[model samples]
Target: MTSRDTLAPVFRDVRAVVFDTDGVITDSARVHAAAWKTAFDAHLRAHPPRDPRLRRPFDVRDDYLRHVDGKSRLDGAAAFLRARGLDTPEETVRAVAADKERLFTERLRAHGVDAYPGTVRLVRTLRRAGIPRAAASASRHAGELLARAGVLDLFDVLVDGGEAARLGLPGKPRPDLFLEAARRLGVPAPRAAVVEDALAGVEAGRRGGFALVIGVDRTGVPDTRQRLLRHGADIVVCDLGELVVRGEPK
Candidate 1:
């Protein structure tokens, strides 16, 4: 375990924390990646790329991390399509995004997801310590996902994709969502910490000037850890349980 004093010194000054929902809190990122693969694969089959190098199918790991993860459905679709050198008209993007949404919803309804035990423990610890917590996600289904995982009540606030759109907040890699979550928690951005599993999310936390940007690397890949650090994560851990608050129960 990484003691707060050693690994998370900023926690002493952190007034609140904002977490990214999909991969950080709940195990739903893989579901989203699978859905994206199905949608993108179908689209690719119908419209193969002329370039041989770009003709390969979407890689759930690399493709999702680079182009789709932590982005809104439409934004993710457009980004992946562009990366594959496919035409990215608004209509095409929407069509692919819609297909992903349908597929994701079906999978979610069929097999509900669970919250990460470590994350739940961390959230509970923070709550017991009187620190406010917020869950922020690019997915509009964030709330539903949390509710299904039985961890929605753990957060004091949630800034989801629906709320972001309603407030005209831009997606990840922008500080809007994390900033809003901090704002709702009644804490200044510089006094709050942001926990995320996505590169874009860590970048947003850094751009927001949050006190700490903790990256959750569930993949356990050395390259992923380095990438997270390069993306502005102050520290990276494989699981939330590794983070131990000073004078707090293990």
Candidate 2:
């Protein structure tokens, strides 16, 4: 049984939680980063940087965190290209994004994703406690990935890329996606919590006025926990398992 000593403090008033799909719940964030590296590196090699100073390969950690993580494919591609001083045409952006999509899909198919045991434990605890929960992401493949992980049924609501497009909601760092998920859960933003690993996602939760924003730092990167806090997370945890409460619910 899980110990209650490390239970997440936000659950005291947080009636619902909206979790980001990637690093927070599943172990697929690294895969996505790898795919991004492959696509971006190929593009960079084909169109070498005009400035030698900027003639560097795509950095999976720094570059992904800065421009790709938690963003739409096209947005990521455009941001990365601009960072490399190569803000090409819309067609070029679309092509790059398409290549990334293909690469990610192939990787996902070859090696399916797995839900983090810590996350699964916390989610089951939330379910047993009757706390409403939702899963939200900017990626169109969010739903597919969740389904493949076999944890799709754990969420009461899902506001993935499809729903965002249907509602024309803006992406993260803008609170629209999280706000929408909270609305669907019939809970006010201040009554819900957001669990995210992306800096943009934490900022979005803060902007949305959520009760608490928990940042999951799976990467164990230096200063990452502090970065998440600086970005807007009320508290940072290394794993969702830290939030699991054993024994009976109060």
lDDT values, one for every candidate = 0.91, 0.89
Native RMSD of candidate 2 (Å): 2.2
Q: Which digits, one per residue and each the tens of the lDDT, describe model 2 over residues 46-142?
A: 9988988777988878788878888888888999999999857999999999998899999999999999999998988888778999999998888
The window of 10 residues in a row where model 1 has the poorest summed lDDT is 1-10
lDDT for each residue of candidate 1 in 14-87, tens digit (9 for 90 to 100): 88999999999999999999999999999999999888899899998889888988888988999999998999
Task: Tell me the TM-score of model 1.
Answer: 0.94
Ten consecutive residues with minimal summed lDDT in candidate 2? 1-10
